[model samples]
Target: MVSLTSPAEAERRPYGPRHRWVVLAVGVGAQGSFAAMFSGIPVTGITMRADYHLSTGALGLVLSCLGLGVAASDIVWGLLTDRYGDRRVLLTGLTATGALLALMAAAVTPGDGAGVVLLAICLAIAGALGGSVNGASGRAIMTWFAEGERGLAMSIRQTAIPAGGAVGVALLPWLAQASGFRAVYAVPAALCLAAAAATWRWLHEPAPAATATASATASATASTTATASAGATAGAKEAAPDATAGASPDIRQKSPLRRWDVWRLALAGGLLTVPQFAVLSFTAIFLHDVKGEGAALASVTVLIAQIGGGAARIWTGRRTDRGGDRRTYLRGIGALAGIVMAAAAVLTDAPTPLTVAALALGGLLANSWHGVAYTEIAAMSGPARAGTALGLLGTALFAVGFLTPLLIPVVIAHASWTAVWAIAAAACLLAIPLAPAAIRAR
Candidate 1:
């Protein structure tokens, strides 16, 4: 996989291997916030219901607001990172989000309209800023790693989302059980603040060095032009393409929409997301409503899924490193997910252990494509515009995710619980063709 990297990309990519782990750590930290922010939906539903006297629909509205925030802010954060840099945006966003999460914790209480509205606003901010993680972290990994190794690295980074979410699910409930729902928000707040500090201390904008070098090179070229013009050589009067001007054009032309590869990545990302978000958003509901499970049991089941998804993420990354085709793996995972989801739909009457285990395995296979898909995008786009490409991919996937709650309820309303699972299975099936197209584009 010889990467057709621009000189700017080549210069920006870390030559030494030491920076890879640092980039991975940054990715993990950024992604961990995503899990924390979104985890509120499952644990805080009862609290919100009690506090705000929210109906089921009202609770759904509150949760959906977070998705709306992410959808609205993803592109903005992406552009900011591309233009200014990731370090400042990431650090500031994380810190602000952490404070807001804590504030939201205090504000969301019984009979508190102002509090609820404030909480919603804060959640929106968190979602929007947290959305930047994909772009910033993906860009870092892509810029720091070589093509052959990027798939594995990017996969590992992608795992942080599920892994972080799983931790949140496990921790928040136990905390809420012992203390209150406030603990759920409080824990993430602390973690987010810590991540913000860590990012500030350790993160560096790798491209600044490249920019400086380009600037110096431009200055030297200008000096040469001045000298040539002073000599008044008619042969040298032709305006050659200045290296600095060429570099500036490269930056301007880095839009992901202009690239065929980016569109394929986004489409494949959307296909993969349809199922993953469905499970993430609704697993607790399925356990509670269909399987006659309690909140505790449902939360536990969701936690199991998260664990499977997280472990599978790291494993998938390692497997990709060992020469697995990402497209093949994604389609295979999707197919397996569809089969398992179908079984889950039809076998809803199965024993508790069997049903739970089936869903856990389903989660594992369904979410395993996280690393591979992003890795492919990073590889396909090369390093220079990795952030832009990943930003577009995240936008498409998150946009699909925004529909999960709405779409799934429609299935559950018209049909039996089995029909809901069947719908998810169908969604996974839709990903089959896209997987090969995704790999071919890479």
Candidate 2:
């Protein structure tokens, strides 16, 4: 089983005190590089539709392909991370993704139905490869950072999504406009390659002593807790073993596939993504078709949302690290996201700027909870099973990611954009109930 090392142990390693930071940077790079593809690809929705001669529904299918691929592969990658380690999985996945994107850039072109089909197939494959980033990078953070610091560390890692999205929205639309989709594909390929290099050079396992120390710490904590429960009433005593099960090294070492807390958080996380993906997948098109705004304004709005979301994630992480209930924060964030999305739905016919601001705010709030949710998942499952827990969460998230886009167009056809946002708001609200009530952080 994989074990988490404290920062102090990391500092004493031969690689230098700052080596963990290097690992964090590489994690950020790996995640951001893939984010550039999955999150950024939607930024080019307008261009893709025009170039590929696709209807709105067809465009959504293309977008959903990436999510579908990710959903399919995340669990596999997560299991692999537990077995093979972070560096190897990340290197293999990132390198292959880069090469695939390079080939896609050269071969994919505007032409017939075949072109759209081919592009979708390639994107699905890219998403599968890129899915490696989440579990591996997250596990690396869990391994290197202690409990007190992991919220912040993981939040910093989570920022890569919006940060990469910011870069993609800022650059890819213009690239698609100025050059073509070829350039857009090439850019992410380069990012993947660069991140792969960094991972190869820097990411490595913690010292064996650190792993042993962490295991001992976990066992000691469990023993203390079990001892404390010894004097409880009969009913409490009966529940003691189950309550302390998560703290046991034996339980910690087991796969997190069946953990109710893990599934609860995973499902909640998936539901929360509805609002986020709504903004991400359709904002540009909405601005263009409904608000009569150009791609530039749409891109700028998305860029602002991404930047704000990233900053919000960092702040939320730090705040939770200091003192706060992560589950409480998560539910609160979800509630606010639902409220904001509902307001956005109501304001769809309002003044253009007001509508834009509402959507942007909804996007920001929807995105801000990721770090907290992920931190809760890892903490509940323990560091040894962080990969499996994270992977399970990823599968849920990307499965929702897959479905949201494809369904959005159908909602638009039958109902309206307001209905779409309303449903998204409902999804956020629904997720609030699913968050685990309390978790004993590892």
User: lDDT of all the models against the reference?
Assistant: 0.65, 0.83
How many clashes in candidate 2? 0
Give the per-residue lDDT of model 2 (tens digit) for 19-108.
Answer: 667888999999999998888889899999999898999999999999999999998999899887888789889998999989888878
Can you write out model 1's per-residue Cα lDDT over 1-442, one digit (the tens) per residue? 1112344544655533455577679778878866765864555565455656665545555666677677777767766767656666677677777887787678654434544566566666777767767787777776555543555678778778777887777677566656765776788888888887777655654455543443354345444544545421221231112201113455435566686656765776676666666666666667766676756765676677676777787887665544455656777888888898888777777888787777666766777788877776655555566666677777777777666655666666677667767777887888777553422210
Candidate 2 Cα errors over 4 Å, as ranges? 1-13, 111-114, 209-246, 439-442
What is candidate 2's CA lDDT for residue 41? 84
lDDT of 2 at 343: 97
RMSD of each predicted structure: 11.4, 6.1
> TM-score for model 2?
0.88
RMSD of 1: 11.4
For all predicted structures, in order, the TM-scores are 0.80, 0.88
